[model samples]
Target chain A: MTADDPVRDSLERFIGKPMGEGAVAPEEVNLPMIRHWVDALDDRNPIYLDEAVAAETRMGGVVAPPAMLQTWTMPSPVIAGIAERGGAPTAMKSENVVTALDAAGYVGTLATNSELEFERYLRVGDRLKTTSALESISPRKRTGLGLGYFVTWITTYWAGEDEIVGRQLFRIFKFDPSTMGGAA
Target chain B: MSAGTIHVGDELPVFELPVTSTVIVAGAIASRDFMPAHHDSEYARGQGAPDMFMNILTTNGYVSKFITDWAGPEAMVKKIAIRLGGPAIPGQPLRFSGQVIAAEDKNDERVFEVTIRAANDLGDHATGTVVVSLPLEPSS
Candidate 1:
């Protein structure tokens, strides 16, 4: 697809716009969630759990796993009939780029890349809020699965109203499965 | 290891993760991702996946553990950038491997960039770089 393609033109308007109102984590950074992750992943990193051991290190105290930055702001799941909802933790909004792509017949989704940057280790009591903005959308291209467009977005994690703690760039390919193996 | 001791081309010890349904589900719930593909095998198969697979958040969690286990507690991760490929499904053992590709000193810290790859029989699950830093002087 070219830049002039109506679908592409429509998506272009979303670039640099906030995906939604954004979200605030329902809970602050706390030990229970940290410990659950530590056990689940078997991370065994002392700084993540052992206060005494963590205190002796340069970190000076316990810290949440750096990778958990994204986990903190994940929406709480409404378990009832989640599978019926196609695994969406909650109801999805209707006007975002994702919904737009679905409406445009590009329904298949595959994550392609992730880039996470952390400004500092999150300590207990730090509450995080997230604001995600659409970054870019590639012109449609043919792939093994089908014809697709790559959509990229950046989510900024804030510790408070002003302090940015981390950021993540997430990209995914949205394709039309029906177009698989059609004309190149 | 201390920042002073790190060098480019250094290889971190290999860490292996035994992927299983429990592992996948645990990581998903812990990460607050309710994606059925990470838990319900039937739903995943219905969606054309071979089986339930690990989520990205779980993959990043393991990746962080793999790096910090080698770099130790003093090392604070600055960045983790990875290209996602293939499914991390049950019974496939994902082997974690990495090598320090670049090292530099800036102000009071030494930063190192490490190239990492996590793979299983199906293929490479993730491949990319992680940036971590350590204080030039140990705090204690």
Candidate 2:
């Protein structure tokens, strides 16, 4: 859409706002979940499993896989509800951003890409908090699925107030479900 | 496995996962991603996906697994970036393979960067790069 379009104008307002609550993991950064992740993916890294092997490394302790950045802060029903009801969960008001797009006839949603940079590996007991903001919302564009807009968000994973453990730039496409007859 | 030993162009062993509807749904739940497109094949079909497919989180997890498995536990994955090329359609097994595209020394530590790809018969499911930190020598 154009800059003057109400949808774009309203969405633009949320560009620098916090996306959601400081999502807390249901559990801590521990071995069980890390083991489960490795099992699911069949990863046999000794550093993640074998204590002796991990001890030999400089990490001196088992560290969670870096790719678990988003998994550590998954959205729960409560968060979804907050978004649906237009509640301000946090600074990057994703719910408002998404709701605005939905009202504009972009209902179908799909994650397109994710790029993560880690400053350090996540170790056990290292709790995380993420702060994200709407980076940009693209005008409607045609693709294999259908016509939709690309929404990008930048998220920073923090271990504490000043320790930035990682940052992820994620993108998603919101389209109309009616355009479902084409190739994926 | 230490960073100093891994040379550029070293190919990592292939890891395979036989895709299935159950696997797809289970992965979706594990990652707490319930977008109907991942669990409901009918809904997914209605939304234009061939059937239930793997989510990006699962793909990212697999990518991490592939890298760490090859780099050994000692290798610390400092970064992993991925782009989805296609869906991991059910019944099509995914094969993951990678090559060390770059290696260098950083602060007396070895840093190895790999370009990896996961694919099925339909096409590539994901392609990405992983950066890991390793000691100069394997610690026996």
- After TM-score superposition, the amount by which residue B52's alpha carbon in candidate 1 deviates from its true location, in angstroms, is 0.3
Docking category of candidate 2: acceptable
User: Residue-wise lDDT of candidate 2 within A140-166, one digit each (tens)?
Assistant: 677766877788888988885678888
- Model 2, stretches more than 4 Å misplaced? A1-6, A78-95, A177-184
| Residue pairs that clash (backbone atoms under 3 angstroms), model 1 | none
TM-score of 1: 0.98
Top candidate when judged by lDDT against the true structure: 1
Superposed by TM-score, candidate 1 places the C-alpha of residue A160 at a distance from the truth, in angstroms, of 1.1
Q: Model 2 TM-score?
A: 0.85
lDDT of 2 by residue, B10-48 (tens): 999998989888778777666667667677677678766
Worst lDDT run of 10 residues, candidate 2 chain B, spans B28-37
How do the residues A1-184 of candidate 1 rate in per-residue lDDT, one tens digit apiece? 3645788888877899998778899999999999999999999989988999999998889999999999999988889988988787888865889889989999899999999999999999999999999999998899999998999999999998999999999999999999999996
